[model samples]
Each structure stands twice: as structure tokens, then as C-alpha cells.
Target: ATTATGGTVPLTDALELAQQGLPWLMVFDHAGVPLHLGRTKRLATPAQRLALIAALRGCSRPGCDAPASLCAVHHVRDWNTHGDTDIENLTLACDRCHAMVHDGPGGWKTVTLDQDSQFPGRTGWIAPPHIDPTATPRVNHRHHTSELLATTLARIHEQRNQEREQRQRWLSSHTRHTHAA
Candidate 1:
């Protein structure tokens, strides 16, 4: 497929390229019948890019410090994988980091953390098992240190609360057994 810049893009990348550049795309069935218009939630508009810049602040790859201005909006689920261009499915990634993501075993993976996670609505990077044995998905807090601190404190508080509850349960159970005795 050809882009508006007169450059040729692979068929797999055409949708993403069009989403970033074209206002809308029309689809036709094999018989030339009109299909669906693709303008809805398929383009990463300027507003969406700005929102991503504010949220991600920079490349979503963990430990990468590339600034947001030097990054491109990337689909977390991937355009070819039926991923929409919505803001929630988007994150910023530098050229280097962007190329590192793929379906291969050595490639990196990006996902949107669930709302109940330590970092909700954030892009998480899962490294290959060779790089990280546990394959834990981690977020980059380089551009937003405050969030790192906040999440850490929240985890500590939650752990302490769980410990306290466990202790209370043990004490209550011991007291009941003593009374029964």
C-alpha cells in the first residue's frame, strides 16, 4: 500500500500508517460492495497523541529514557492484530524500542496494565524469558518518578494491612480456643 507521502508501506503496516496519516479509510468487499468506514477509533489523532505523551511521558519500554517528543505512538496490541487506535491501546516508543517488539521468543511485548494492577492504565513491557526468568511485566517510570514512589508506598501499606489482619485473626482464634478449653 502507498502512503500519502508517496512512500510504499507493507500491507501489514498499511492500516497503522493510514491511521496515523489519513483522515479516514473506506473498505470494499471482494465483490466491490461498500463495507464499513474506518474513521471511528482507528486514527491516532493529535489529541490522542497529546494524551499519550502526558500519560506515558516517554517511551513505554522500561528503563528507556527516550523523550516523548522523539517517540511515535505505538499500538500495544498491534494494528495487524485487530487492535484499535484508541488511546487506551496506544503508547509511545522510540524507533529502537519499537523495532524490538515482535512475536518471537526474543522479542519484547507490550500490554496495557489492568485497572487493578499497581500501575493502572499504563503500558507494561514484558521482556523475553531469557532476559527475565519470571517474565514479569514492568512499567517505565523514568519520566514519572512520582508514580514509582506512590506505587511503592501503596504496596507497602497493603502488605502491612494484610499482616495486621492476619495477626488479628490468629489472636481471635487463640482466644476462642482458650475460652473453649
Candidate 2:
């Protein structure tokens, strides 16, 4: 199979299932060609949104600190032109950057660079080959640290809730025994 980057790679059914799930949106090409990006009928799923929020943090543009909450989910590929509303093809963009992407001064395009196992779903932008003399790739560092912290906090909350429930059950049993006596 071929990736968006035009590289040849072997894709297994297991890999695809592990990668994306069809809930609200999906696209299929029965012609046996995936030259163009797939399209989505609905917006991103909640899980997909959360994943992108953690992954992209905020705006995928370099140096933009717009929080994911305030930013809009953008289609890296044009929505009208075969872009799917999946997490893989979606990124967060604040009002200004979102406009710039669609109507910027020099014409820029958003692209998803292959991130290491360390970071998943990271987004980026690149100039057209003709526009960019060197075509350097840029990575956004918005949510990297925050996401790690968030994960730790979530674990703590879960543990606390479990402990609280356990304690409440014990207290209830003790009170019943005391009243019976």
C-alpha cells in the first residue's frame, strides 16, 4: 500500500483496524485506487477529538499556542476535494491561523509529518516546493509536555476515585454493624 507521503508500505487488515475505526464518518474507493485522500461524511469522533487535542495540543502551526479548546478542527486536505474528517487528516487551528491557511499571504499547505513513537498525530505545515526554497519540516511542541502531565493526572484521579469508593463501602458496612448492636 501507499501512504499519503507517496511511500510504498505493506498494510495489513490488523494494522488498519488498529489504526482507524468507522463510527461517524468513512470513505471507500471501490476502484482499487487510493490516489486521492479519503473523505468523511461527518465531523471527527469524540475520541478522535480528544486524541487530536492531546496530540496536536493546539494549533498545528509552528509557534502558535492557541489551545485546542479555542481552535477549530481543520481538514489538512481540502474538505471539498476528497478530504476525510478523520483524526489522521484533521488538525487544530485557531481563528487566525485557520484563515491564514485558507487565505494566507504566500499560500501555505498543512501536512502531517511522520512522528516518532514518542508523539502520535503531530501536525505540521509546509510550503509548496516552488514556494519554499529548501522545504524544511517544522514540528509543533504545544501539547508534548502538557499531554504527559495530563496522563499522570488522569491516573491519579482514577486511583483516588477507586479508593474513595472502597472507603465508602467499608464505612457503610461498619455503620450497619454498629446500629445492629
Residue lDDT tens for model 1, 49-165: 755654555788999988877899899999999999887898899999999999986999999999788777778999998898888889887776767777789999999999999
Q: Which candidate's lDDT is highest?
A: 1
Candidate 1: lDDT of 127? Answer: 94
Candidate 1 deviation (Cα RMSD): 13.4
Query: What lDDT does the true structure give each of the candidates?
Result: 0.77, 0.62
**Which residue pairs in candidate 1 have backbone atoms (N, alpha carbon, C) closer than 3 angstroms, thus clashing?**
none
The stretch of ten residues in a row with the least summed lDDT in candidate 2 is 25-34
